[model samples]
Target: MPKLLASAYKELLLLTRDIGGLAVLFLMPLLLVIVITTVQDGSFKTIKQNKIDILLVDKDKGEVSQTIHDNLRTSDMFNIIEQSNENEAQKLIQNGKYQLAIILPENLSNDLNLKIAENVDGILAKFGVDESEDLPGTIQIEPKEVKLFFDPATQFSFRNAIKSGINQMVSKIETKSIYKAFQEEISEDSNEEIFDTESFIIFKEIIPNSGKEAMIPNSTQHNIPAWSLFAIFFIILPLSINMVKEKNQGTFVRLRTHPVSYATVLGGKAIVFLLVSLIQFALMLVVGIFLFPLIDLPQLNISGRLPLLFVVALFAGLAAVGLGLLLGTIAKSQEQSAPFGATFVVILAAIGGVWVPVFAMPQLMQTLSNLSPMNWGLNAFYDVFLRNVGFIEILPEIGLLTLFFIATTFIAIIYYKRKNAV
Candidate 1:
């Protein structure tokens, strides 16, 4: 207990003396949380902000053309500005005021009318009515046409969504046209239904999550966990540097002669840093809760599984501590240890999705991310924050992180014994 407590106090005193390191421990993560949260907020702004602005030129001035315009406007994904001339629409697109332009030819309505006429006559002939071609005032009709002009810079997903929506709208109009023709020719007693907007079939769509809207992601959910995990791992650099410093000063060599065992010495270092890490986790949550409102971001929300939250934090801290122990024992000098230790943590953070969401990563990279302990910590936090689940839901993540701590600690202890034996 004497060596353990003394080592813990020494670690804290050494950390307090390094003002610059102290700033990085607290300030840098805070700054990054604020900045990255703001960026993600902007990047993921609601579907309203994601809308593409399109200049719509309605040269046809027909019902079908206006119908398409109205449908596009109804969707939150598009902002349609109607214009009389294609040239003006193109100019507006060139000025970058719009990302897309659509022009409908004047013949769309006329062609549809002619098509309906032909369909109507054919149906009438099926009932033994003839001489449809002999009808007066008829002219050859062409196919309906509309032209889409989109900026090359538009996102493929967005551009494709617009295209698919328009295609569906056109199909709907054509289906209705066919239905109208059938109604004129079919008997009242006939129950066949190709298009029944009123009675035969009512279109009802079931949205996911039982029609409950998905929660839009907020800054706190991400920043709190991501930067907190990152800051915890950064313990490596300082812990490694201090170990190298003690070895340089001959303190490490002398520890061997003392009655204290190797496990006790390493345990003391782990205990001290684990406390520091727990404090770091609490500090980030405090900043998110008390300080976030000044900047308009929502505060961090802790789940009802309060003890389980600490369980996640504890295991995450232990895993980081194990890494620090390994780094501290392996390197012979501060110069050799500190930079590599920090860089290694950062790389883990990046792959583990501290800097970005795992969902956003490529398929192979997402699979690789699971190898990181940071990923386990993040999933556990997300279960608490996003899913609003209890301890049971995060058991797998907790288990993995705990296992990681044990394995790394065992390996580091064996290596430390080997190195000191020489």
Candidate 2:
């Protein structure tokens, strides 16, 4: 007990003296979280709240074009600007001045109405409802094309959404025109409406909550947990570098002459570094809770999930410390440990859904992400923070992290004993 405490005290002393290392462990992650959250929040707002400017060229100059314009204007998704020429609208879209442009072909309204009227007259005549003998013969009318121009930089998904929306709007208009034609043919004597144009099916979004308050995940919610895990695991760089330094400085040789096991030495480093990880996590929470609102970002709401968050953070710290112990044990010099530790942490974060979300990744990458300890920690954090899950529900991820710590620490101990056995 005394030996362990002494070892822990020595590690703490060493850590406190290295001002630069302390700053790297603490400051870098806060800046990363804040910057990433701010940028992502802005993107989210742009997609959901901001309206896009679109150019409309109505060459037809008739009811169909007017209806299209009115529908687009009322949708609230676009700021429609009427352009006189299709070529001008195309030039504007190509120059990236606007993301989208709609060009209604000349005579589109006349051709569409003629086609509908001919079809309706034929149907009514077949049903013996057309009393007039002067019904016009079947006339072939070519399909009118509505040309859409998109900016070169437009995303494929955004383009597809625009195309679908425009298609649906046009289809509805055509259906309404058919209904009016049928009403004119059937109810020529009466002025009663035949078809209801109102939509019956609509979509509603449902967010799962913990029975207290609805927790809609924003950029703050996503980024805080992701970057916090990144910061925790990044402790490996400093922890491993410290180990390499101690070895190069003959501290390990001096400690070997004393009555101490390698396990005791490892325990000491783990305790201090684990505390550092926890402190890093706490600082992140503080920044998220207090500092975010000052910068016009959403405040992170932990509410009743603080204890569970701590539990995940503790285990995540253990996993990080175990990895550091293994890295330090294997690496021969500060040069080797520092770069490798930093790079490996980044790779882990990349695969762990820290940078790109797991769901957004390709299937093979998503499958591979499960192997990362950071993924386990991030999942546990999300379960507590976003999903509002309890301890029992988070056991799988917590268990995986615990096992990772045990395996890495065990291997590190074995390797150390074997290396120094002579």
TM per candidate comes to: 0.83, 0.94
* Best candidate according to lDDT: 2
Local accuracy by lDDT, each model: 0.80, 0.92
Lowest lDDT block of 10, candidate 1: 207-216
Those runs of model 2 whose alpha carbons end farther than 4 Å from true positions after fitting are 126-128, 131-135, 189-191, 210-212
| Candidate 1 segments exceeding 4 Å error | 49-52, 83-96, 113-152, 185-195, 198-217, 303-305
- Candidate 1 Cα lDDT to native: 0.80
Residue pairs with backbone overlap in model 2: none
Residue-level lDDT of model 1, residues 176-293, one tens digit each, is 7777667655646446665675445558964343343333347788778888899888888888888888889988789888887778877888887898788888888878778877
